[model samples]
Target chain A: MALIGILGGMGPLATVDFMEQIIRLTGAARDQEHLPMLVANLPHTPDRSAAIIDGGADPLPALLEGIDLLNRNGVGVIAVPCNSAHHWYAQMRAHSAAPLLHIGEVCAAAIAPQVTRAAVLATRGALSAGFYQAALVARGIEPVLPDREPQECVSACIAAVKADRPGAAATHLSDVLDALSAQRIDAAVLGCTELPIAARELARPAFALVDSTLELARETVRYALARGWNRPV
Target chain B: MALIGILGGMGPLATVDFMEQIIRLTGAARDQEHLPMLVANLPHTPDRSAAIIDGGADPLPALLEGIDLLNRNGVGVIAVPCNSAHHWYAQMRAHSAAPLLHIGEVCAAAIAPQVTRAAVLATRGALSAGFYQAALVARGIEPVLPDREPQECVSACIAAVKADRPGAAATHLSDVLDALSAQRIDAAVLGCTELPIAARELARPAFALVDSTLELARETVRYALARGWNRPV
Candidate 1:
């Protein structure tokens, strides 16, 4: 069974959420039945969005350092849990020996066949970079975005979640989801990793949430299974 | 800052819970402000309880593999979240270069000064091995064990949570807590990692629940900070 390395700590909580989802999706009855994972939660990496949008320092070197650690530690493939970090997906892949899993690409591929129209709720960095927009267009799904008012709500909710105020964030995010529902969108993609925590807290009955984190988790399971790392349930 | 290596996947969700707590405890506003972690979630390790109490296969080789992975990966310290896994803490420390954080010691030290009498809710393996009892005695605190009937309930609840039926487990665990409350115990230690999740879902108002997982998380933060990994919030 090949090991899956997670180049994480874009925000530490998201990495924990992604790893939990992978374990839940794996359906393991025992410890050995679960996927073997090497998580490098290097929260010390420079902010991806700050570097991308602002004239901040490049995060590529720090990211490369994490990737190098994973590669040296015998990980076969790497998955980055943060959406904003995906802006550097090309560069990360360019420098790494192991294949990198793009959360947006995985979410797009998983949702493409299911829905014709979708809305994305993510960090300002991801939204500005059109990370999911590009993937959605390539998959033939029309991307719907929130208006300015709701976009502000989205950013605030993301910030609230990052600061560990998930309950408040969930209420505000549910309002954003309601606004999108009013637009009659078929589904919503929680493009940011933290959004899933809020979505789960909202406890809405499966209102067509296309969670990028869960999609990445499923892709992780698929990747491990393809490598023959499957355990009998 | 030294990387904190987690020897995880004794039951994968516990590892996730522990990692998430570490992130929340660190209280970092950005990625770089958080502690770097190297988690080797090797779920293939044999059942700790089964091996300890029921003469199941030795999980030492698997544990050693995980410990060795951390030692080789430049991890300064190691933390194993599962309470039952601590039965082998001595052997694990003996074989590994990185120092091990005894979850029991951390829990005991945290609770000892606050309360004189406390009851423990843990796996049968931990109870049989006298894991927490030894630590509590060392800390000059009285260790209370549930009688056979309540102990069976504890085991059942632990199994239910491991099987992912946290709701049922919560209900059953609440009954165990009530039983302890009837005995007038000052506090109860959620000696098992899964118990804290169940207890939180119960939403009881500050009934003096001492969570070992949360204590371990705090200890993890302290360990990093003592090594000069402190980040300004």
Candidate 2:
């Protein structure tokens, strides 16, 4: 099995969820069978929106440092659980010697086959920054964004997730989904990992909801298995 | 107030724990009053111990990329919650424009007046890498490490933490505490954040335990307040 290195703490809950996904997906019989791992959970990062919109702080340097830590440790591959951080994925990939598994690309690839046009429900910063839009467009998929009011609500939902308020976060996500439905979008991508927790609750039979996080987890498992990190039982 | 940027996901659980600490420690009512946060949880970091001890892969470039992400976003301060990643603190600090908060320094600062000679109970990688020793020495304090066999046990405990075996992990910490008692040490430092969760269960009235994570939390709160991020109660 290959050693796994994790750069996390974008929001503590999301990070834990990602780890749990890895464990569940790997289905290791014993603790030793689980992949050897290294984690750098730095929670002192400034607000992503504030950094981008208000000139507050950037989280890229700490992220690169974490990648370097993992690279120095000789990890065969690496994965980051944060969505917004993908904004700097190009620069990060340029610096890393080992292959970096892209959460956005993985997620995009997963839902691409299911929908032709999808609306993104994420933070305003995510939309304004063109993080996921560019990715979707590159895949020949039409990207729809939440309107201003809904965008603000999406930001609030992300904030609620950071504050550990799952209920309030879910409410915010529902509001965004409503807006997406009003726009006649085919499906909605939970661009923010936090959004999925709420997205699941708001999911309906008519609406196709895509969770980027879950997709990333599945992709990671496929990557690890394909690379011989785990032999198929 | 200066924005705090986090580069995390050393392990998802630890990252969430750190974020909880930040939220709990901060005295804020509204979301905006709380310090703005930017986080990039990259779980794809290469294994630190494997790379360092077994000649696996390098983690430096990934870490630097994280830092650069935060830097480009304009984060004034950066912090990484993973104790092992501090091994390259000097290098990361030198490379980034933002000052990276030192978890070891924060730990040392918190415990300096409380204990004179502190025993370190941590992962083999952390102990072998001299992360705590270097921090303690800089502060004029003596660090006591566990003996060989127990140290191996401590490493096993850390591995348990990575494996998400809380009970086994705690038992390993308890065993290490017993060894510290045999040495008649004044106090034991939960050098690894995972160790504290375990240490708390085994703590006795006579034994003093210093938790680097809790100390970092307190320090982070102070930093936020000092910078006027928190609204006055």
Worst 10 residues of 2 chain B by lDDT: B27-36
Q: Over all chains combined, what TM-score does candidate 2 have?
A: 0.55
Residues A122-145 of candidate 2: C-alpha lDDT, one tens digit per residue: 666666678678778888889987
Model 1, B161-191: lDDT tens digits are 6667788888889789878877756778899
User: Model 1, range A57-79, lDDT digits (tens) per residue?
Assistant: 88888888889988988888899
Task: Rate residue B202 of model 1 by lDDT.
Answer: 80
Which parts of model 2 are misplaced by more than 4 Å? Answer: A1-233, B112-114, B200-205, B230-233
Across B1-233, the per-residue lDDT of candidate 2 in tens digits comes to: 44566776565445556666776677443343555555545545655666667776777887887788667655667878778777788889999898788888788777746566888876666777887887787877789988998887788777776667778887887777777787765667777766665555564735688887788777776776787755422
DockQ of each: 0.61, 0.05
Give the TM-score comparing model 1 with the true structure, all chains together: 0.90
TM-score of chain B of each: 0.93, 0.89
Q: Pick the candidate with the highest DockQ.
A: 1
DockQ of candidate 2? 0.05
